[model samples]
Target: MKKVKHGGNIYEIAEKLGIQKEEIIDFSANINPLGVPINFKKALIENIDRIENYPDPEYNGLIQAIAKEHHINREYITVGNGATEVIFSMIASLKPKKSMILAPTFGEYERALMRAGSQVEYFHLKEENDFQVDDDILKTIDESFDLVILCNPNNPTSQMVENKRLIKILKHCEKNHVHLMMDEAFIDFVDEPTKETMLPYIMNYHNLIIVKALTKFYALPGLRIGYGITSNVRLLERVNDHKEPWTINSYAAMAGMVFKDKIYREKSREWITSERKDFFDELKKINKIKVYKPNGNYILFKLLEERKDLREVLLKKKILIRSCSNYKNLDESFYRIAIKDKGLNKLFAKALKEVLYES
Candidate 1:
């Protein structure tokens, strides 16, 4: 199968441009701008020797931390290298005969479903409706599909499924005996995540599964820590027994401490809440693009004019924004950008105006 392109490929960009990767202002990846917590870095450094030993296969401590954070049973939790691993493993274990996903959603779901030999279908999000999930999704997901994947506060579009609608879909999936795999990788970046999450329903609905990652919120992508939650203990056991040992390394196991860092968590909330609003408002002032109000840490916009090469133009200025043309339902005129710090956000807005109007 052909590999799907994802953002955060600074190495490739640096090689092509003959400049250091650090020199480029990357808005391509929707990561927390505050970066890795200082306390976590200090702990990692102090315990660097932990890498000499292999990580516990059970990952008891990591699982405990995650379980505590969500107030769920530890038996329901399964850890993986990243959310991507959890996604693939869950699909493999479920081995759905048929699956459905959002047309312009995360590409990995389709790849995983294909790997499991399941026929794939898409629920296209209409751009005219601001790419929100509509009632048509309810009709599309019936007993015919064995598995349905949802990315909350979905990528590229940064639009979330309304809580009421999401609950309705969950009940519908349950009745139809279809497994609902909700990827909450970016949920922590959204406002009122507690209300938006479906964790509370896990115990009541055996058909629901949640995949989450500390990679984006904690800025620890290199550490590769992620997990899945479901009330189906049998399925969790199957995921655990499916294969490799020590997929999560020793250092990654220590990432459990990040969950307890209340100060860092609060500061991140403050930063994202402030930056997303101000930055989006500034971008809206630009007449050349139609900015979609974001519910996540990033924003998606469409070029109003005929600038098909906007990404290329911005790259010349050492700026990197995600080109959404490669997404199944989106076209070349669309792009997604991370909401960064105050200074960087202003720089991007200024550079964008120069690209759209000045040149």
Candidate 2:
């Protein structure tokens, strides 16, 4: 299996441009602009010696933290190196023979499904509809599919499924005995995260599984900690049976500590609530590209004219944005950029205008 490429690779872009990675402004990865939490950093430094010992094989403390955060039972939770491990492990345990996913959604789902020997199908989201999920998906899913994956506030597009419609899908999947895995990696950044999350549906629907990452919201992508929640004990046991031990490092296991950082959480919500609207409105003013309204911490836009190489041009100015051409439903004209700090976002907007109009 050749590896899949993801955003946030400032190192490679910097190397190619003959500059330090920090010199490049990266809008490629959808991460919290506030950076890692200060309290967590201090804790990490104070307890650096924990690395000398192996992480708890079951990651008890981490699971407890996640449970407390969601007000769920520890029995329903499972941890992994990142969201990908939980996803792959879930698929491996379920061993689905067939699965369905959104066409332009996260790429890792398809890879994991394939690795588990499942035939894959796509629910192609149309660009004309602003890439939103609708009732049409109900017709596409049936007993034929053993699993269905959804990325809430989907990557690249940054559009979320409406709650009523999302529940309908979950219920439909339940009726068909299909496992519905909702990836809530970006849900924390959504305007109404509590209302939009599938976390609440887990206890009532054993078939529903929710996976989340501390990577984006906590700005700890490098730490590699993520988890999954479901009410199905058998499924959790299966995931544990076949999983490798100590997948999370000692530092990553301390992820549970960050959940109680309410100050950081409030500040992050403030940033998204402010930045998302401002960034979307600013991009809308640029007639050269069509910007999609964003619920997550990123914006997806399409170049209006013939400038398919917009990504390349922006790189010359030491700016890196995600090229979404690799996504199934998207084309070369499509791109996704992260919502950074106010100053950096303004600088990006200026650089973009210069490339499109002046240059």
The prediction achieving the highest lDDT against the true structure is 1
User: Per-residue alpha-carbon lDDT of model 2 for 1-359, expressed as tens digits?
Assistant: 54678888998898888999999889999999888999999999999999899999989999988898999999999999889899999999999999999989988988898888899999999888999998999999999989999999898799999999999999999999999999999999998999999987988999999999999999998999999999999999999999989999999999898888999999999988998888888889999999999999999999999954998999999899999988988989999999998898899999999999996
TM-score of each: 0.99, 0.99
Model 2 weakest lDDT span, ten residues long? 1-10
**lDDT (Cα) of model 2:** 0.92
Question: For candidate 1, lDDT tens digit of each residue in 259-314?
Answer: 88999999999999999999999999999899999999999999989854998999
